[model samples]
Target: MKKNVFYVLMLFFVFTACNREDMQNNPGNIEVVQKDPLTAKEINEKINETIKTKGRFSWKESSDHFIWSTIFQGNKIASIGFGSSFDRNLDSNNKAIEAEILKVIEQYEGKTERILLSSDQYLNQIDVAIEKQETVIALRKMKNIRYLEPADYRYFENEQKLGKSSSGSSGCGFESTALSASDYTTVTPNAKAPWSFTKHNIINAWSYSSGAGVTIGVIDSGVSPEQTLLGSSFNNGLSSGRTISKNGVYVDSIWPWSTGYDGPNDQCGHGTSMASAAAAPRNNQGQPVGVAYNSNLVTYRAASNVVLDGYHEQNGVKIAFTELGNNNNVKIISMSMGHIFSVGKIEDGVKYAYSKGKLIFCAGGTSTSFTNFVGVIFPAWMSETQAITGVKENTSNQKCDVCHSGAEIDFTYQMERASGNSIPVLSYYNGQTDYVGGSSVATASTAGIAALVWSKNPTWTRDQVLNKMRQSATYYPTPNSDYGYGNINVLQAVQ
Candidate 1:
């Protein structure tokens, strides 16, 4: 009987120990242990659980704006916004526009900070926590204030927008072949150029000339500053002859800050990829190299996040374009974003930049239905911009998928992505994860080719450079929309 009692005691102790461990690590109430946001599977399970319990299960966390991307540190700003006006001609009287905007925002303004441009137009960095759309609607009620959109941009997190992919057959890949690196203050590791060099004949184009006196502008997420190959040439990338605009306006060669962080920061990782496609440098191994190795990379943070909401807030974008266009040093500007939003300031920005003798490359977008259903997404739709489409051809001789191609597209460029956990492009990124494959990637690649040709023919006008690219592009079919002008041939364009 004593032995039996002791055995019972031992069982009790073991039970207590197990229960204690469970309490410390994973409690019986599993819901209490969940810290991270729910994935699709988890979300479905949660909904079903709530339904099964007939509203017994209460939601754990709640938020108005979904934290789709990397949650930044520090106090989350209550609001963000950009500058706009009911009067389209407000740009003509930029100062008046600022004064007028200031008056309107006064009602809802929490912290007001605006950067007044030489055009007298000011982009409101001032933030308000209230409903900006509703406020804008109310503001429009006041005469002379037709437009008052929020300047702060938000994109659905990469995971939200483009669901994480492991199956190479599915998902998007941003071909950042030569996405330009950040303004190099310093670099050490030799660049190991990737196979993409010879893949697109960029190697042969190198034989002719690499972008030397050129500056390329990348408008996207943001960029990373400490690139080994890109750091080789920093302040030296500027075109001394045309550093400042003819209007006497000076835009810095490198505008690296994105969102709130000062200096180079790419949260989404797309910006660095896009920049590398524009102008990564040749390294010892050249594992990751840009098309315009010799050119400088100037990153423009137009959006705080990936949500471009049809560019209702065009102020920041306008400033970026204004800087790139006015600065003669920036000969090419590559934009890899597209949306269903109608023609607006984006079209104007492209027009303005092109007028300033800068070649512009824009992404065509991957929505297959978009190509057949509505039409090409703008600002790629804009005539002034060279809308680049994507083709998935492994080799020059391979027949590729139409993918993002459309008749409106100016040139077709080969894009790459890997199945599972591989990033195929020669690229650089700040975030832990990366992605490739899109019209944007193709656009950057094409921009690199243009940079190559332009580097060889430094004196060539933007028009001449564009024509050479179109004429030299490989052919898919004359009347086919599958491949526009055809894949860009760097060798042929240079030859």
Candidate 2:
């Protein structure tokens, strides 16, 4: 009887050890530990700490638990991307991969309903709830899984919830300031030409080409419906035979599956200024004129503000880029908005646009609430984009007080006046003008110059036009450490 009991005990121990080994290998049945949400201050501190130690911060390297704790506090949903961003042929295969991923989630969570919140139509990305860390670990090990990050993380919203006032400082404002007479000079037809036009000799370039044949796509807040200069009056005065189209892709909801798109209108004043500075008509009604006054314009309301901190903002930008990329008429694409770090979807969108032969320009960076430590922001820091920043008049090395400069900066625009003023643009309202400064206006102005170059050489490829612009810039053979190729001489470029 004792010998039989000993044999039975050994068999029980052997079975228990086998079960433990299976659990270690699979991890699908393991329970995930829940942690409390992090405060806004804590989130900022963690990001800063990562930047200090890692030289750069990426959501790809962060753990799934940390991302959930910091970003998806109330909801446990996570955004994920699979397949190569550069592979255009992976769309068909992505569906099968997505199915396999869903199966893995079902195995871990023991559920099959409502596991997928949303999936992108163009790119290989999806949004789903991740209740277990083991699911994240399994997803990471899967083939072609690019990234997993928070889809609806809004830093400024969290700050506001904490009773912090962030007005006029987050680069988001609806107030339009009155412009001074000194800010512009009266051109033909009683139009107000921005003072920076003389600094860059854009007036001379107009004699060669007014960006007549090229179309510029401005991805920003939607063009203001109140500003008639960008609407019905777009073809008045010297600017005629061109068109302006406005699009809105921004979704004003936290839900990724929401289909309601905010209409094509400038709820924020920033987009109106950017549009005016790039392609506002040179009308006879004493309104401010754009650099490429005759260039066709297509503006998109891609985000609520200049800062891209939420899922909808980033998603809208991606959609805008893809749409602009497919538009054969669009030769140049400009965006004055960006995030402090790289967002995977945005990166993929930019690459797609670039692949379609669109000359893309992005803002180097403007001063923000917590981005003082950051350099050139993404997607400006990307190689596929030409990074532009604001420089003071009469000097290429001196940047504007609110603009950022770094090695990634590819060009500079003389937008900052000596008298503490900025570039003059048509106001969001009719019959008025406002002054816009920083890298935002600079990038748009650069895009206008590119339009002029492309218009002059209509048959030239995108690289040929870019090369001509580069050869005509201040520093051509060797670029500056902080300001790449310096400022482009618009007159020389058009010639």
Q: Pick the candidate with the highest lDDT.
A: 2
Across 251-275, the per-residue lDDT of candidate 1 in tens digits comes to 2222212233223454455666676
Clashing pairs in 2: none
Q: Report the number of backbone clashes for model 2.
A: 0
What is the Cα-based lDDT of residue 66 in candidate 2? 68
What is the per-residue lDDT of model 2 for residues 1-495, given as tens digits with 9 covering 90 to 100? 999999999999998887763552366445557555566577766776776676467887776666766544525677778875543465667778788788877887678997898776766777787666667666666766788777777666665665543665545555567768887888888888898998888988888998897899999988889889999999878898999999999998876667778988988888899988998888689888998999999999999889887778888998899899889999999999998778877888898889889999999999765566678989999999999999999888899988999999999999887798999888888898888999999999999999999889999998999899889988997999999888888999988
Backbone clashes, candidate 1: 36
RMSD of 2: 3.9
- In candidate 1 the C-alpha lDDT for residue 338 amounts to 56
TM-score of each: 0.58, 0.91
Off by over 4 Å in 1: 1-196, 232-262, 310-315, 367-375, 394-403, 417-435, 476-479
Error of 1 at 157 (Å): 8.5
